[model samples]
Target: MSTFDDLDAFVATRRQAGLALSPDGARLVTTVAELAPDGTKPVTSLWEVDPTGEAPARRLTRSAAGESAAAFAPDGDLLFTSRRPDPTVEAGDDEPAALWVLPRHGGEARQILAPGDGITSFEVARDAGHVVVTTTVPVGPAPEPPEGTQDTDEAPDAAAALRAARKKAGVSARLHDRFPVRFWDHDLGPGRPQIRVHDQLAADRLTEPVAVVDPAGPTERVRESAISPDGTRLAVAVDVRDPGGASGATGDRGDPAAVRVRLELRPTGGGETEVVADEAGADHEMPVVTPDGRWLLWIREEHAAPGRAPAQSLQARELAGGGTRTVVEAGRWAIRSVTGAADPDVVLVVADEQGHAPVFRVSVADGSVTRLTASGAYGDVVASPEGGAVYAMRATMDAPPVPVRLDPHTADQEPAVLRGATEIDDVPGTLTEVHATAEDGTPLRAWLALPAGASERSPAPLLLWVHGGPYMSWNAWSWRWCPWLMVAQGYAVLLPDPRLSTGYGRGFTDPATGAWGGLPYTDLMTVTDAALERPDLDASRTAAMGGSFGGYMANWIAGHTDRFDAIVTHASIWHLDGFVGTTDGSYHWVRQWGDPITDRDRYDEHSPHRFAAAITTPMLVIHGDKDYRVPIGEGLRLWYDLQRHGVESQFLYFPDENHWVLKPGDAKLWYRTVFAFLAHHVLGEKWERPALV
Candidate 1:
């Protein structure tokens, strides 16, 4: 069987991410993740693809520790980061990742910038080759430098030594005087991110690093950044807390204040900082400086409120103190990333639009927008310095991400696929579109994947797979919530983009902002019913499954309807009131759902936990202990509620995993368990527990 037909093979399939274009646009490189020799974890390696699509793609760098964040310096040298041990120093397992450079003329890769704690990410200036890097530093004052050099700034290695001393003393405590003490899956404690500049970058070494944007409090950090083509100015998006706290009474929940991301422009060589964009209730990020250094491009998103979804648009400002203009109007689409185009007046903008994340060329001069690609989701875009071909990674439901070259001048043009590090020769199913109108006359659509042998005479069992983010779409390929795996097992998977999903304009997403179980839930059901009418699907033996927000809907559907034979929810919310207070981003959710204490109407009406007694369908609940976003408490409460109500159910728990089961072995088990559950309840097969449970 092929990879899609076997869970083991699927886990071993090589996955690719990150794309880098050489300065002259002669070479393209990306990092590919593959299972390690021990078969315990995945390691990444850099691979180079020919820009002209003439020669086959080949490996560029390899190491057990792996390499990532690849970028090309102006001198043609390739730069990357890896945790590989430095040959010149004695390495330990705790050694952090360091920056390395591969010579342009083809030679051995050398470690150039190996700070004590190591670098997190770095960007290379297009023209000057200067490097700007972000790294973590201890929150406390730096230990004093050796007495002789008191006049000079603290030694570069002082902070590293202090960190080591703390480790030696077994001090692993983190004290936070802010709202969010944690992030997605990890604690945001003892150290914060700091930006540093390196003016001298050599083939074999780098000059001393200078602190640029140092955070004064734990609440401050850089959101996004970009360096100008001339390497003289650095644009950064910084997150800072507002002096006034939340709009309503915070009630001593450790809530500091509302946070806003501001755009700032600072000189590279230590000078005054200029606040370019600082709106009161909005965030500005994803900075991209035009090739000629004439215009600065970034995304602005207003804060979301009850019944009012966050509106996003692209902003372009003249670097010479001229006024800023909205290049892409609000409610048009949710912009993802912006890249400088070959033409100085034009910039490439990628946004979700009608079930696809396509590239759009926006004229920075006139605020005009033109679609460039016809279909497929695109990301990591780069344009040739001489205004030639534009390169990006594109993916569709039927295919994984692959490098593609696009034309900057053409509108809705087909992208030319370039040879990538890995390829899938076959997919186990066929993909087609499913459309339906909501009860309110709003349009709804979905992508249906049918098994290879599905037909009217031999229909495939159905699985309605709702996407997460209630705010995101099922447009691109996702290795995590893949549908091909289900289709390979003789099932038709329905991938729906309901009202809450992006790409359909703000009108589609607005109604779902505060009313989670209202329009979005009904839209999902409407699309599923439309798909069930197909002759190639067996509607009677259907199951429903989803993760995150989709999981919340699965719970809602279980309480409201019993059309499906079984339901599977992963990393979901059970109670809106409890979820808002405990989630990492509590303030953000509070704005959307209202205060659970004072404004309790929405919580009482929409929370799925309140309807647990009404559910009759068999359920398989899944959650990870490390999932701070959804929290494992939701899963435990759901399991207990199911048992108390005498509902047939099973709990799949991951103590070491997060919101997503990312480990190879755990991900394989996740699929096996879900398939087994569906096979028994939906296919009328005897229940058989997964092995190694």
Candidate 2:
């Protein structure tokens, strides 16, 4: 651990093993970014590797500008969205993201659409003829011009006259002003784009698309859409509210109202949609139709009471008969993903149970499931087309991700190291499971990373890392860069999945339900106290850190306790009252907080801002300026308040980053800043002061 290198080499080595293999298992696409010579901004590129070894790996798209959401068409052609360097539109205006297609073999890339169309996402049809593009269209007529349009004294100016005429005709003056704009806005907005079957083969095709599913009404908020294997049905997962009203509730756990998904049958010939399967209350996900088109398999998250794990049930519906049956019951844990195997009667399901996400096969007939892979590392498992072999991505904390092939028939589950061949060799430290007792004496699971030279006599500085989601968990596996970097610098790391973390029964995560600042915060205190009890940890020099919900905890901890010498909070919510008003999902937060306007005392009392004056620990706040979730304004308010209260605080803002720092250079810089802050405050190391701006 003491021999760890700089952040650049570390990230590069880590990324080597992070490439995603295509479904065909022939091509690999991964994001790569290089630091500009001046080290200001990153120049990003998406590279491809041919697993067949027939051609050398090549860079498909290169630009100083950032790009993401890259994927491959069914034919292995590259399709990605990119923001062009030169914008033809005015600043602060929407510069439409253009979709580009590049041949796998390599050739000139072609831009499919121009700017101003507001194309968000496009998926090629199974036949590869036409792509179903999602864009926003005006809902209603735009605002009209000034009242008095025709004036003889005005001399009928051409531009003004044209504008006046258009306004009189009910035309919108600005693009965004047009109503009923429907685009593929992911995870945001009142309405999302529905999956429309488009025909590329048609010669007289206009951009106008026939709506396969109407998302205009209150019954739908399409989160994601997937087409059937035979392309005959569309599965849409939406969080539907009440008709003509909002689904209001207390708590961020989404609307307490029932959740349902509709499996609509789409005939090749245009016709009305037929509902194949419909279920209510449970949160449904990963709706995949079997290859034979007889059954549709999906993962359903069954809602739990205030203190229980959301039960994950695997279910399948007979497409033709319109009857549904459970393949797996609502277990203590949740399922991740499911896919149709070559065996039409069986489906592959991935679930996280007891801190590990494993793959299993479930029979469509009797609902019996067989575990395929038991390793709980955070990785992906894919079933082969033949259903005999399974390919997986295995990751550990210290090691990069590797591809593992499993043959259930042979009972072989060995993994082949795919990436980071030269890196992560002889990684120091061992992973150990530790448990802490919550307020009610319930056991909370956690992972502890011992320093390379850890011993009772030479206790190492402890870095307590809290996970986000208040619902997410910290599992064993490849070491993350931040914690590993700290460990390499001679600090021990303790990651606790306190109450409210997933994987455990819903009861564990329910502690944070309506008691955001109550039981959950107590759970953190319990974990931290347990960490301090370890003889291998230096309790006097402890530091705490987390992001998102975890970030909120870090801020709360700093304000409440003087136990930690330093703290780092990222994308954290400092004030629940402000968060409910400023965040993109303010409604969700309001629901979580039990009505911000009505329950002002509950919101304010739970917020870290209320306790800011009690903070004695030097803190570092890292946030993304463009983050809509727990916006940068939240961080700014915290920093300004902390400064006003005479607490030593530092704030770092990544201008172009969103909720998560995706760019390589920014990530490296972020790690560097965190390391510097921790080293100076916790380890008493000399470091340059961070540039606050």
Candidate 3:
């Protein structure tokens, strides 16, 4: 079989993530997930890439469990977390992840910190030897921090000991004092996620850890935390919900599950942390301090609701306690991420622009946003400490993400691509930007890919591939949802940013804020219709497919119209009323959707199930049992709905998967089944099921 046609080669494609620059700006590190020699599972390991684009990338660590969350310590040591056991120092091969440090000069990686509860993630202080670690511990009384050993596999904490005891007793019951008892796929009861501060005592061991910011109302999970360069101040995002104790029976305004997450700035020494940035109906997260420690910059996200439009703006405040001000509100585009630069006058930012995720340098002095990269998706941007160049993972429709270094002033002028990473089969297609006007006269756009062989003589089949995260723009290189895959099957894929999509200014999204079924759905159809006008696209043979929010739209399309030959929905929301409560966080959707009990109009009007009886086209319903965001109940209910309605449908269920199909074999089967289904419906070919499935 050809390389592109082989499932193993497709799965072996480069999977790179998490880029970090050394303090001296000489060396760089990134984690890549590659198939092991045994070809059983994907393993993540640290790779040292040349920041100057002068040399080939080299592997830094090797292990079955692999390494992750790497950061350069102040002393030039590479700090990372791994589950691999220490060779000289006895440790469990499949044990919980522990912090390991590799010397700057080339030596063996030594186990530094191994807490009993185990560390999920860790961040090294830029100037200080302190380290901030996030871990899950038993919710019982506090115990003395036992001295952890570098050369031993012993866990020195009471929490870990109690957990073992509970398992031995076969006690699985968990008492919940909060609204969300479960997250994406796992129950949150056995242990609660907490942030603890620890110091690197020496080269081999770490000091005792201490819980600093445990709130009183409800248990909070620290999603992301950043420490100041000097290690004096810590900015953290604590995800918590308001467990209502108001006057009403069901609590304030009949919504007991309302939640709000805030970013707090506090001294690293564990004192009262001030709420640096908090909006009534918004979320503040990923607070990063400037290199000079003068400002704490954070991304503010306004929730979209019935009358209000969603917005993402970069806001900054004086580190000495001052009111926050909008830094780049004029841009209108949602800022993806912001990284502080050595130059205090400017900070590097990444945001969606039209159909591309480009790098932007926002000047703090006048709040001017400057486009750095011309046109492509860029993320994991880090400014050099020496103030020379900016480094990021650049990806486009034509290529996957590759580490690149760009001139600080004119990044797009001559961005140097760093090599030594695995390459993939060059996508055999032509990528073009296309636009259309919505019903309300709002201009919408999408990135369309047409197969190289497409022609008017034998036009390729059209596939309206809707992107997930209805709010997120389809800009980056996505191995999971590459349009090239379908293009390889002689199909043209239309990736539209219908509505509520970031980029293209605020006016493009505000109109369809909470009204999902209104303009956004039409915008999608509008773009799809416009793309079909191309001579190389055969609109008569077309299909529509999406996942998550896109899946919701696919379900909506199945119910509203029968324009396409078939519809494929994965991890979709079938029943709106049951979904809002059963989802990972109800409060997030409740603000926009309102309570299903009180404000039933939007839920009833926007829900796909309300119009399921009108579906006439064949559909393939795909979902994973482990998906807690849109639980298995949704797919099960959706399948039964179609069966009862006597609609032509097929079900693709994954028992061991989550919202995303991550395994190599599973993903191969997914693409195979999807193509086979499309072939039967769109191409009018005999249905030939995937060999393995």
Tens-digit lDDT track of model 3 for 452-496:
888999899999988887678888778888778788888898988
Model 2's alpha-carbon lDDT is: 0.64
lDDT value for candidate 3?
Answer: 0.81
Q: Residues 64-119, candidate 2: write the lDDT tens digits.
A: 45555565666667666676533333443434566666666778655555434455
> Considering every candidate listed, which one attains the maximal lDDT?
1
Measured by TM-score, the strongest candidate is 1
Distance (Å) between predicted and true CA of 415, model 2? 2.6
lDDT of 1 by residue, 328-350 (tens): 88878888888998887898888
What is the Cα-based TM-score of model 2? 0.79
lDDT of each: 0.86, 0.64, 0.81
Over 4 Å off, model 3: 1-3, 88-90, 141-156, 219-221, 243-254, 411-414
What's the number of clashes in each of the models? Answer: 0, 24, 0
Q: Point out where model 2 deviates above 4 Å.
A: 1-4, 11-135, 138-194, 199-221, 243-263, 276-282, 302-312, 376-380, 408-412, 419-428, 439-441, 476-481, 597-605, 691-693
TM-score of model 1 (CA atoms): 0.96
TM-scores of the models, in the given order? 0.96, 0.79, 0.94
**Cα lDDT, model 3, residue 603:** 86
Tell me the lDDT of model 1 at 571.
96
